[model samples]
Target: MNIEFKKNKLSIALSIALLTNLSLMAEEKSPKELDSVTVIGNENSDYKSKEKVKLNRTKMDIEDTAKSIQSFNENFIEDSQLQNIENIITMSSNTVYNGDNHGRTNDISMRGFSGVPILIDGLKVTNKMAHPEVYNFESIEIQKGPDSLQYGESSPGGIVNLVKKKPTKETLGKIELEVSDNSSYTPKLDVAGSLNKEESLYFRLVSVLKYDEGWTNSNTETNKVFIAPSLSYDVNDNHTLTFMAEYTDETTPSSFGTYVNSKGNLVAPIKNTISNPDEEFEKTQKIIGFDLDSTFDTWNSNFRYRYIDYEGDNGNVHMPQSYNEATNIVSRAFASQKQEFEEHALQYTLNKEIDILEFKNKISLGADYNKAYSKLDMFYDPSTPYLINLSHPSYEHLTSASEHSGVMDMSSDKTYVESWGTFLQDSIYLTNNLIFNAGVRYSESKPKNGQRSDALTPSFGLVYHFSDQTSIYTNYSESFTPNSQEDTSGNILDPEEGKGYEIGIKQKLFDDNLNLTAAIFKIEKENIAELDPDDPTLSKYKASGKQESRGFELDINGNITPNWSIVASYGYTDTKNKDNNNLDLKNIPEHTANIFTSYYLTSFGLPNTYIGGGAKYLGSRYADENNKIKFDSEIIYNATVGYKKGRWRANLSVQNLTDEEYVDGALSSNARGTRVYVGTPRTLLATISYSF
Candidate 1:
């Protein structure tokens, strides 16, 4: 069947069902008025948000939900000046910034698991290599542990969801410019307001332009452009419609940094680059989506649809394969690739609050469908090795090479994946201070030219509120990810399965201004694909590997006083491969911690001035699965000062304050241990903004 035709058919069916539900809801009689529910937290001190949107596909209070969820609001994003997803996620407990795939992907890991999926407004986008820009987001939410009941075929670790800024009825505008010591400049604009006299139609526009000269010796430059526009229309008192679109174009240099030598030491200086300076990676992405929300006398419903298109071309790629310390030469491969990805997703959810057997119950049910297509074409000339002398690097390689002296190998792959799932959950209020949460999902996945996989996942939780300021909870959940890889016999492997268990406690402190949470969790995954021991060439694989991760985390956020704001977290993780004599997982730190605090100077007579500072620490980790090579730990510090008065605001930030030289993370490591990444050097940035 034609892809477009199939999509249209599904869309039409979903639309008709939505209309029918709306019609039925309209005829229901009104019920007794319920007490109003108020959202907590204020704009003045909002490092921590009290509510989350994607945890359960509804705006639920964090204290009432029996899950470990962390949220960073707009105030924190602006105060810290975080630009990318990597910077934002590292602040959360048990999360690490894995090496960026040489400017290709925003690689990250949580609880010893990598490749965690990212979502925009509770919808998945298939382009994992494109890093999400944070300029247009209102908040970032991270749900820890398996969440297959809400999102299908996701990593067992967790999921990151970005809530976009929407159009508002009141006029608001802001323009800002920033310059950094590393020869980087950025300009941004945001405007939102009502578009009609009745104040029922609203529009919002957000845009950013960024340019940066290379920070390393290779002088690899970067340029990026991002724009987002959205509209909201109040069709009636009971219904609203919102439409949004986004476009992004970017070009960045690929720097793989240096590798570990035979002596198990870093081969090059922190500022040096091993890749050719002329090579570049280009990417373009576009998204279009719409959402409809309806409220009736007894129930509420939301329908959302999104489509994403992404393309990329990596030119003249260089990958380090091995290093000879005796000659100070690194043997690398010359390669190139192109990739295209597209995704279409639809979701509908309904929620109702009712009295069952004289007890209040909140019921939620939803269904979702997603389809994605991806294609990759690669070219390599490994016979003609590119040798780089670490002592004296050279950038005189071919500017554009389609023909080499050696034989060139080319390959291509195309894949199509479609998945659908339905889930139902309920929160039963057994008593005024106790609650029980249970949910289940039926999920199925079908891949072109691959086997079909299905699973039934269930979750159970209980929350007990000791008082208005204290609570304790425990939960269990399961997740599954379909596998496309085949064995030596051409038989598809079974999907990977995971199960998680967690228990946590929450407490409100300092007049209910600060929220504190501590939790312990254990997760196990089975059927992980690994190389077959009997396959000498290592070209074939089996799906019999098993791994486990156990960890404890502590987090605190919010205000200590009216003028003092803080965010802090610490996590310890232990991961082992059950199939390999309990070896440690590669690139996963055992300990991680972050803390940031800011205070207004009102008491010191500078009412509009503030100062903030923080430090991030990553413990030592192994470079390879065998744990033969270990990388040392490091701490990076940052500080900021800002002044806001009238319509003008100014700020200055210093990153890597002590000019720390350290290995940030690694992408991959073989017996030779290559593809390591270096942390950023000391840099200063200043910004000026005007608001109306």
Candidate 2:
């Protein structure tokens, strides 16, 4: 097979290419063809376990994909101890985290912008940055760089996807109960069983409950619930069908602690650690989705339906102002905010493998329909309008490290939005070792009080493999986002749009035990819809929407040896306004790196023991676009010691082990003054777990 992809191709040529290749698009299996069919048959022979078997895909199998993709399994998550989607940034080399926002708020930078899409089990999830629950996932796949053909009107940064666990013929399950030093308790139960009586049917179920008092001296508790059920049936020895559904709900408070000083240094917020169980801020989210599939001797088909409801509210709790000592001020302020977002999507796919031109080839065709609706209500009305004279404890919003409370607007904040899109894509394996992929999309978005636009975006990509251990790939993507809410004075801004290109190479070694990847990427943003400075023309400004970002990356993750595993990354990024030439992208550091590793002490002495440590480093960054000032970069270190014997385990971990003071994030909106938040300092956590 020889796969050569031209940049521009008429629809007629692609149709003809597919119509003329019967053996490669149909499911009819012949003796000689059975040896090379790439669907779900012979490939199953690669490993003793399904986890390993799933990683055997070569470059030719995915070269035609519409986006740049990377896949990881349970071992990857377990080895990294990823908490949720929020922690995924630490797991992927191409990702950078802007703030902890205490999980209440999240800002991401890929290429150079935010607002990328998320997917579950291959279906679009939500574009909002809120982290989704991760209790029932088997693996995760990231499709980045370019994606206009498969998903409509998306940000050029890329896509994040989570693959659900399916029912298998084997009965497997785990029940775990863990307690941490922060007064956090989590109990989880997961079970998968085969319907032996049906021979071809299997089922799986999972549930979890978590509560934490938190690292803050203020008493707080967080909880989550997740349930996923799946059923898979073998229609025959060569075909199988599966059905699955997932649901999750959770809430966490917004601990808006700030940091800042007049001399441009960091400061801690004055807080009340007392127990006020009734005063706090929070967020709640829920998601539901299902998928269907059919397979034949040579081809496989699938249908997916996904629906999600995400809503959150942040109010009440008194948040601190900037932590700057020089600009120290305690003001009476209040904010009441609420958001509601909904998504529904449907998709269909067809894939097959065949021999042609003296070579074996693979093909994929798919179409998708997506609809999204959202609305947010926001209001900020301060009680003590001006910073109270801190020297005077009786002044408004000014008290000791404990006594301070003010009124926040409770009735004036409310807003809403709605949007939708459709997309299609195709992948053709022109040769046994090379792949080509292309896609296109159209979308229409309408907000309650803003302009609406219908957009079309196209994408392309290519992948070349040297062997099962290494591959090289490149891709292009585009996206659009609208800014709806507005201040008084009958004023509004335009929407934001992003575009970018990425190229990289990946290597897998040690019998699939170690993986390494490196890539260079560039992303740009235009029509940013910012405020006019020169003319203050409200709606007209030349440099308002101009911005660009460029960077290079190196990342590696996997077992150094059977008992030693690690994940590490280093990135250099630079973002600026193309028009103004004097502004810097806030929160995006010029340098970032993280290294985490673990080793089983049992390899030398004990059979069920481990020791681990890691560190995360963020370089100095701007808190505003002007780049007039900077926040010192800081490094956070962690260490852990644990042992597992039979069905029981225990461990002690120290976070910020060196007590290295660090700021998780910083920002300045609608003001000349900057604001920042220092992440936790030195803290210790201990955990004990058991399974029956």
Candidate 3:
């Protein structure tokens, strides 16, 4: 009963606030004048103008789209000091970060599912799961629900796209240095300008270098280097070309985390605990891409090609499941795994605008092809394991046996996966205020170890504009996920199929300075891949499971007043596995909320100063499939202060202000041993930037 009351109260409070703001705007501006209002504001304003692509392959206002989409603009990214992709995911609505032990790789979950695809500038960089440097992108787009019609196969969670910063005609540059309480130091530079007198040749360059001493008491350290360069050339008024390249290298020589003890309890042995002194993680990534954009009198076209390479080596310490409760002695192991990946992809789209039988119409056709190859070599030293006294531990005896043997075995062999897809979408306008959307796609995927899988998915949506400031939208979409596991006959199982439905409302108030969104959605998935009951082996699988999820979300962003800005969101999700006796899914919270607000002190004689704070809450969650183990809820706080004068800006930000200890990510409970990643404690960062 209390939960219901709180939900109602939140909905009522937000509704009242939005209505009050709308009424006040109505009194200040005439209807004709309101028509000229824009939802996007300047850098100083909290709101950003909409520049996201719609499902129909058309550039339209986000408020007019039929599905839920969110944008984190450059201004907000800087204000929040979002230095990494994981930081951005933490701030997104209805999202959860599945942190890896190393804190370098990111896996995000939404709507009770995982494997959310990540794209760069509408192109797939890596399907093998990788994270790009956050500093290379200008904006990040979050699309919710089943998007298989546009992309290919995907989980029900949704997708994230990063848009890179392009070259500009005017000279713009910024250099910044940051110092963090966690013994971390970073230096970054961004410069973009034209290269020729014609103003048609432009270039942009971005670089970052970071080094951090051990955050824990262990003898661990981390270092990273990143560089990106891009160029743009205009052949004519209707034709343009762009080229982009990026490289990243990161290394961490220490492995530190908590482990599950014999009593099935998570234990942080010690701050100075180092299972293996020689443990290290190293990664390198490179990407090169080009874009060809053309515009004709009645049609528009875009063609893109990209090649990406990624390699990683991890020689890390491990905690074994064997623990002696009486003597407090736990077993430890070691592993060395190396992974290599290469991908080549091409994507093209053609769109035409026309008038059909007095109704305006926009039609688009697109095709994408991707080929990926990956190899994995893993060696584990579990035979001669090391024993550790949990009460008083010493790692002097722990060493890799392979260092002396010089033989590295291989596991999982080599994997090669490829996919191709074609799609068609159309948007028909019944009237200037009402729009209908429909799309269909056919995709095929083949893995080296499994048979081919094909899927045909379709989507439909509608958007109705009640007024210039308000709109209501609804969509029905389908999705499919290909299984990499092979059956006893060496044939892949049928792809898991999912269907989703969503309805939402978007509104603009206070002369388009504020934006509000509310949405409700549900998804059902079938034919989920599961272990073969009779012959449960790593090489065999079956598809006979089902799951369902229902959720609702509310979000608000923009300026409440000329001096005050706010961003807030609330999400509620309910999920169950039907075949598993309706057991709750693991690692998904039931309720989550985040609120951030900032105010300028210009009126108080501090012309260029600002202060802001935020709060994040995650509800209790189940840790295992049977729901036997659970993790308690937690609330975190953050604060920021900044000043901008002339071309100089400086900011100080603190995270986890209350020093809360929480688990940011974890592995499945069904595993041999559950690995838990502890969240960062209270930390401070100070940065200063100068722009020209």
Strongest candidate by lDDT: 1
- Reference-based TM-score of each model: 0.91, 0.78, 0.89
Off by over 4 Å in 3: 1-45, 53-56, 101-104, 127-131, 254-256, 260-266, 269-274, 316-330, 389-392, 401-408, 411-415, 536-539
Provide the clashing-pair count of each candidate structure.
0, 22, 0
lDDT for residue 129 in candidate 3, whole number 0-100:
30
Best by TM-score: 1
Report how far off residue 268 is in candidate 2 (Å).
Answer: 1.3
Clashing pairs in 1: none
lDDT of model 3, residue 397: 41
User: Which rank order by lDDT, best down to worst?
Assistant: 1, 3, 2
Model 1's TM-score against the true structure = 0.91
For all predictions, the C-alpha RMSD in Å is 9.9, 13.6, 11.3
Error of model 2, residue 616, in angstroms: 1.8
lDDT for each residue of candidate 1 in 1-692, tens digit (9 for 90 to 100): 86434533453454345335434543342543111112212324457675556645744578878888888888788788755777788888989877777666667788878778788788766564456778888888888887788877778888888888889887776777788998777777777778788989999999877767758775446777788999999999999999999999887776676877633467777666676766677889888999999998778898999988888888777766777777778887788878888989999999998999999888889899988988887777777778888777875564344666563657557788888999898889999989999999999898876788898888888999999999999999998888777788877788898899999999999999888989999999998998787877687789999999999998888889988999889999999999988998888899999998888898998878889999999898887878877888889898999987765678899988999877766777775545677777888989887664
* Candidate lDDT values, in order: 0.80, 0.58, 0.75
